[model samples]
Target: MIKLIGVALIAAGFALRVNTLLVVLAAGLATGFAAGFSLNEIMAMIGKYFTDNRAMTLPIVLMLPVVGLLERYGLKERAEVLIRRSKAATAGRVILLYTAVRQISISLGVSIGGHAGAVRPLVAPMAEAAARGRGGELSAASVVSIRAHAAAGENIGNFFGEDIFIAVGAILLMKGFFEAQGMNVSVWAMALWGIPTAFIAFAAMWWRCQMLDRRIERTAADNAKAGGVQ
Candidate 1:
């Protein structure tokens, strides 16, 4: 039972808004001690696991500098300019399009879109440009809302779409977990089940995007009215 102290520590640390890395390390040390492991053994286990999964961190390390360079060279401005050229584009429509593309690409096991790599530099700016092209100046709050919607679209698309690829890490993880529990679930079946979930996620996000557009329009109107009153 003392082995579960780690979970309690994690909950308390998060609730208290402690530094995440420190909280996790403290929990790990507490759990190791409770389980009668020496500090050196715990450190070795932690190092081994980190080394085994080190590949996962490589993409972020490689992607950040590349994204930074592109942004420095006007990637965001170009995205905004390109989006503004479309007369029919709205912020909602722009996000909906990116969500669809993200889902489709990730379903094929292509690691294309992410918050830092795509949403921040490309999608958010494009959506904001689309909103501005709608002929009203956006309030600071509206701008923040548009960026939030952009990030949400990426998250929804990635979360639902990755499971559709049978070879993806998430599907494999589920297969391993179920097999350990003696359920004998197949990878193909898990991937198949994800299709309907992906569709549902898309539908829900589509509705939310439409609501975002309406909200933007309302904010614009309110701002216009306030200007007139002053």
Candidate 2:
């Protein structure tokens, strides 16, 4: 339907790699107009919503500049250099450590970084350098695998860890849901239970990381064998 033009625009914008903020704004305006809102009414609604949600948006808006400043100052390079100098920093260990960092920071209600804001720019690069340490260049497949693990580490850490923060949305949502179902559940209890789950999740990921290390080694060996045969 023509009413879905806004959705189409959003999809196309993303597919075409347009400016994200502009794409969002355009989608909003188009949707509002398609739904019979006048220009002034839509403008007023946008202004009011923006004012009300500024707190949530502020961090994301400010994050770009801060991340940009750090990148400009060689944060990625510094991370690589530090890890490369550490002989014990294997690819799996590096990712596990990053997962630990992510979980700890998120549990404390501090969001350090994410895949978009951190992984691609910082974590992946540091991991690549660490994994490549004293081993010459890695195969393309090996490099992709390391980056994938870096991204997964961020996801596992943040999702599990944030539930441990008492005031986070998950605790509040669970509390509300339980109350709605005529059951009593306290936020503290919910947070306490989250700790065990987070711990278990961390342990599972740790085991997986160790497995990943073995897999990478096997891949490297096979690649070397193939090259030698050639």
Query: What's each prediction's clash count?
Result: 0, 0
lDDT of 1 by residue, 5-92 (tens): 9999999999999999999999999999999999999999899766755545565577778767877898656755755565548999
Candidate 1 accuracy as TM-score: 0.73
Best candidate according to lDDT: 1
**Model 2 spans with C-alpha error above 4 angstroms:** 1-88, 181-183, 227-230
What TM-score fits each model?
0.73, 0.63
lDDT for position 29 in model 2:
94
Error of 2 at 191 (Å): 0.5
lDDT of 2 by residue, 1-230 (tens): 77898899999999999998999899999999999999999999989867754444455476778777887898757765764565656788888888998899889877767888678876787777766773446878778888888889999999999999876667766776686589998889889988998999999989988887777778767767777312
CA-only RMSD, every prediction: 4.4, 5.9
